[model samples]
Each structure stands twice: as structure tokens, then as C-alpha cells.
Target: MNDHWENMARQGSRFFGKMTASLSHEIKNALAIINEKAGLLEDFTLMAEQGRGMDPKRLKSLAGDIMKQIQRADGLVKRLNRFAHSADEWVRTVELEEALALILSIAHRPASMREAVLEAEPASTPLQVTTKPFLLENMIWACIEFFLSENQKRIRLIPEKTSDGVRIRFVGDLPLPESSGLLFPGEAEKVLLRALGAELRMKPATGEMVLHLPKGP
Candidate 1:
């Protein structure tokens, strides 16, 4: 393969790795919850077997918990499908809301695991943006994965507007100490964003990581 193709493949692999790691972490948490629920059910069953009195309400609650877990597992599977096939390379004028929804949906599991919220607010209208959908999604994914991993349960994303563009800000409660030097995407992600006339700025102060996308182009 040519060098260009090789580089593309490598970038794809890296992006996939970031996503898969987050997904695996999500699946693990889901399984753990399922296990705990099952154990609770087993305990209840043993109690009934020993002729212990059981509240009808308690049994109903246990069933409800199991159903909730089933739904959680299903949601994760659907998200995995959306993310695994995100990059199609066909340029499209994607709706910001829909695009952000997909990004947040896939990112939900990992973000929630850390006790943080991934909040996205698009412009009031369709807010169409021209770019490779997959690449943009991957860029946001990279930011979320990095923050969540480095400072587990410490990140939150908020959308804001700049004079010339839109900004996705990531705020953390316990920001990484100033003395600790962290290498955020910096030049590479910036180069890609710049080509699309977008920009990203990571500020450890106030625990903010911002992505600036030009409103016009």
C-alpha cells in the first residue's frame, strides 16, 4: 500500500482502539451491575427456600431491577454498532444535533462510568456543518477518552459559542495539577480541525478542554 493509505490505516486503528477501549470499559461495568443484581436475586431465592417471609413488593422490585439491566445491555449493543461503522468517508452536510447525539450516545457508557455527564447542545436550527462525519466524531471521541481515562469521573462537556464559531468545552472538577505536564492532541488534531476551519483548545485551568468549530465553514 502507498504511504498515504498506510497513514490512514494507522489513524483508523488508533481511533478504533480509543473507542473499543471505552466500549469494553462500559461492557465491563454493565456486566458487573448484572452480576450484582443476580446475586441479590439468588439471596432472595435462598431466603424464600428457608421459609422466610418475603414481601410481594420486594419481589416486584427485584424483577424491575433485572429489566432495567437488560435495557442497559441493549443500549450498549446499539451504540457499539453506530460507533464501529461511523467513518464512511462520504462528505455530508450533517445535522449538528443528530451528529452530537450519536457521539454522546457512543460515549455515554464510559462517561457515566466515571460519574460524569456528557452534555451536548447544538444550535437551535439544523446547524449543518460540512466535514467528514467520521473524522469529526473520532476527534470528539479522542477528547472524551483522554479526559475520562486520565481523570476518571472528573470530566463534563458543555457547548458554547465563540465570536466566530462553536465550542465544546470539557470541564473537570479536580483538574490535573499544573505541575503535571499533559500532552493533549495539540498540533495533530488542530491540523485536522484547521483544514475544516475548526480549532481545539485544552485548558487544564478550570478543567476546560474546548473544541472550536467555525460557524460558517
Candidate 2:
């Protein structure tokens, strides 16, 4: 039992680190764009100081670009903050849709880098469950990373309320192999999911992976 807890701790730490690193890269990219736009604005200002006519439209466009990047950076930071706080407890009441949305927001970064689209279909109704939020996020992310690695063009997530709890279905172009390594990645992830009272089922014909999470933590 002690070893199990220790392993879970390590897994949680690794997941947190991975998420933070990805988020940092996203923020860095946004800042780079903002910096370039600001530099261009400075050049425009210099031109104006030299009595050279400035294109009002160009200046307006540059300002708009900077603002857009700023908003993007702000949103990324907010998501990162929420993710960090999610680990504050071992288990908590989580809104299935909101949790899935948060994980998708972070996982979408890697998908975008690979030129693949990752989308989450809005849940038809609110689905809430009690579980380990951080571990659940890690499991979802691993599934997404696997699909993205398979060169899937688009991956979709659909969350629905189940009789016992909630079910999140991951749909993509390719079917996941039945091998434990391909689906769960590692023993820690598999153990963590079981600890959360979650079950994963792969539907080869439908090209979907469905995760069934119980209502109680």
C-alpha cells in the first residue's frame, strides 16, 4: 500500500511537470509573437518621428495583433493555474465537461504543433463525478498523445452522463491496440486509473476509447 502511494506520487509529479513545461512553451510562443509586433510598432513610431507618413490602418492592425496575443497568453496562464490547483487534493468533485475541457486546452498545444486538430464536443448536459482530477487528466492526455503520434488528422472527445457516473469517449482515425503499454502507457497510469475506479474500453470498430468513471472517489 505504501509503495502504491509512493508510485502514484511520482506519477502525479511527472504529469505536473509535463503540463507546466508544455504551458511554458505555449506562453513563450505567444510572447515571441507579441515581441515581434511591438518591435514593428516601434519602427512605425520612429518613422512617424522622422516626419514620414504613418499608415493608420497598419498601426491599428499591429496594436490589434499585440492585444490578441496578450489575451492568448492570459488564457494560457489561467488554465495553467487551474491545472496546478487541481492536484491540491487527492480526490474531489469534478465536473466532467469542465475537466475534459481543461485537459483538451492543454493537450491541444501538442496537437497543434503536429498540425493536427484536437476538438472536444460540448456535453449535452452537465456531468459531475467524484475522482482524482489530476490523474484523470493525465490518463486523458496520454490517450490523446498516443492518437496524435499515430498521425491522426483529428481527434474528438465526447463526454456523456452515464447511469453510474460519466463516460468520456475519445474518437480518432486509428484504433488503439489492446496492449497495456499502448493504452495505459505504464503501470503507474494503469494503477492510478483503477484507484480512481475508472474503466477504459477500446472500441476498435468505432475507433474510439471510452473511459467509464464511477461516481464515488
Which window of 10 residues has the lowest lDDT sum in candidate 2?
176-185
- The list of candidate 1 runs beyond 4 A from truth reads 1-4, 46-52, 108-117, 143-191, 194-217
* Model 2 vs. true fold: TM: 0.89
* Tens-place lDDT digits, model 2, residues 1-217: 8889898888778778888999999999999999999899989989989999998999888989999999999999999999999989988899888888898888777788898898889888878888888889988887787678767778999998888988888898776555634545467867777788888877765668788888887
Judge candidate 1 at residue 142 and give its lDDT: 70
Q: List clash counts for every candidate, in order.
A: 0, 0
- Compared with the true structure, all predictions reach lDDT values of 0.69, 0.84
> What TM-score should be assigned to candidate 1?
0.64
Off by over 4 Å in 2: 178-185
The collision pairs in model 1 are: none
